[model samples]
Target chain A: MIIAERKPVDEIVEMVSGVKRVLVLGCRGCVSICSAGGEREVEILASLLRLGASKQGRTLETIEATLVRQCDREYIEGIDQWAGQYDAIVSMACGVGVNFIANLRPLDVVYPGVNTSFFGGSADQGIWTEQCAGCGNCVLHLTGGLCPVARCAKSLMNGPCGGSVGGRCEIHKEVPCIWQAIHDRLDRTGRKEDMSRIAPIRDWSAAGHGGPRKQVRDDLTV
Target chain B: MSFTPDIRVFCCHYTSQQAIAEGLAGLKNDGFPPNATIERLLCSGKLQVSTILKAFEDGADGVCVVGCPVNECHNLMGSQRAAHRVLAVRKALNELGVEGERIEMFHLPRGFHPEFVEAVKQLDERTRGMGPSPFNGGTAK
Candidate 1:
């Protein structure tokens, strides 16, 4: 899932300054799952904004709304009835959702409330780590189901460089060497034969470096 | 009617809540003002950043969250999670120009009345120094 975290309150308050009425929009997608831009986070942000404005002797009327998924037009349209009433919107969605909202409402000023972090999953309760680089490629099958592109400090293929010590990455003591983990998993599963073959140099074009990439499913498209 | 600091406290069900309800009968006599309100939650882990900010938004001068000790929570990690959330809210409060000291958390043993009351008193005094929340006039602005 896409992971994100709320930006500092000072920045958010600054974005909506001088606006009496503001809507704090939340997404129930990845941001929500990470507890960053969910309904609860939206309410918290609105309340804090109110207090921030009040300290400046200004009245800030904050409304709260959470769409099922801010990345979708159908859900983004859900706020249409009341979206125009507010002077600005504080979006608690990822960058994609924030842009989607901005595109949908070109005239309305939309501010992002979160810093979209990475495509990852929860590591533990209230802890999330990057797992996928979204490189537009999948090589999990070749590396014991772990993507080196995201976990490796250098994104090395067939790694475990001379820097790997005791299964820990030399770059940072806290991080486990992804290559070491890959080797262990393969050895345990008796896929040792796969480890001997070196992986080919990666093609960068598929990773969206060429430009913004999009997918169209001819079978599903209208 | 006077400008007494209103302290809103959220107590975890297993420990602090039972402490206040069953053990601390003289809590009110021990410097707990009439404006101090106690709310019980099934687990302090359920506490969210919104809840603490809402208390201040609703005119609380200060807020305290009482949770179980580390590694001893009924839900195993509920208290630990609450501790982290409290710190996050404190950072938010500081950024919002409110004194981050307005909120605090304590790990109290189940039914430990003296410690609970002492924690409240300390927060109460700190809040008194901070004065009433700027967000409140007749109502939260």
Candidate 2:
């Protein structure tokens, strides 16, 4: 899932400060799973904005709506009638959702309520950590099912760097060195022989380095 | 008219509410104000941030969530989850520039009527000192 965190309320308030009517849009997608934007979050944010505005002797009208998945066109299409009613919108979704809504309704001004972080999973309730970089490649099978690209501090594909000490990353004591983890796993799986074969230089074109990526499937396309 | 703060207390049914009922029965009037209202929840863990904000939006000066003592919760970790949720909501309140201390959590043992009443009294006193919610008399709801 994509990980995200709510932007500071002060920044959010500044986005729709002058607008009398603001719609708070939430997504039940990745943002909801991470607790950044959901039905409950939409209500909480709307209430906070209203309360914050009230303290300044200004009245703010906030409406709450949660889409099934803001990244999907079908889900956001039904909101066509409601989109025109608000002066501005507060999008409590990932950057994709916010951009999707903006593209769907060009007339409404949309402000992001959360900062899109990375492709990750929940470490625990209310805690999340990045797990994947979506490099358009999979190297887990070669490295004991752990992608050093996402886990390593330096994204090294070879082995542990000099910075890895005591099985922890030098940059942060709390972070477990993924290279060490990979070594242990390879040893346990009797695949330590695979480590001796040096890997060739990786291709960078598949990782969105060239430009904005586009995918087309002739079988699925209309 | 003298100012009286409105405190909304959400009590979990099994433990906290049991104590609150016993406490209310033993008191004639005591420290509770006229606006103090108790809402019963199956478990305090189910308490959402929206509910707390809604209480303040509806003019509550203070909000309290009382649940079973940490490990003694009937729903396993419901009380613990409630504590975490309360802390998160308090942080959000602070970010909104409102008094985060206006909301509190009390982990009360079963049949501890006196402690339950005492917790409510603390909330009442603290709320009185803070006057009304900043959203009061405003068109926020």
**Scoring each candidate complex against the real one, what DockQ results?**
0.60, 0.57
Docking class of 1: medium
lDDT of 2 by residue, A1-222 (tens): 999888988678878888999989999999888889998889889988887787777899888999899988898786775855789889999999889988988777889999999999888877888889988878888999888899998999897999889999998899999999999999999998988878779987878999878889999999
Candidate 1 local distance difference test against the native: 0.86
Q: DockQ (C-alpha) of model 1?
A: 0.60
lDDT of 2 by residue, B27-123 (tens): 4355554567788899988888888888888888889889989999989899999998889778877776778888999999865466767788889
- State the lDDT at A46 in candidate 1: 93
For model 2 chain A, the run of ten residues with the poorest summed lDDT = A76-85
Q: Which residues of candidate 2, in runs, are more than 4 Å off? A: B16-28, B137-141
Model 1 residue A86 CA deviation (Å) reads 0.9
Best model per DockQ: 1
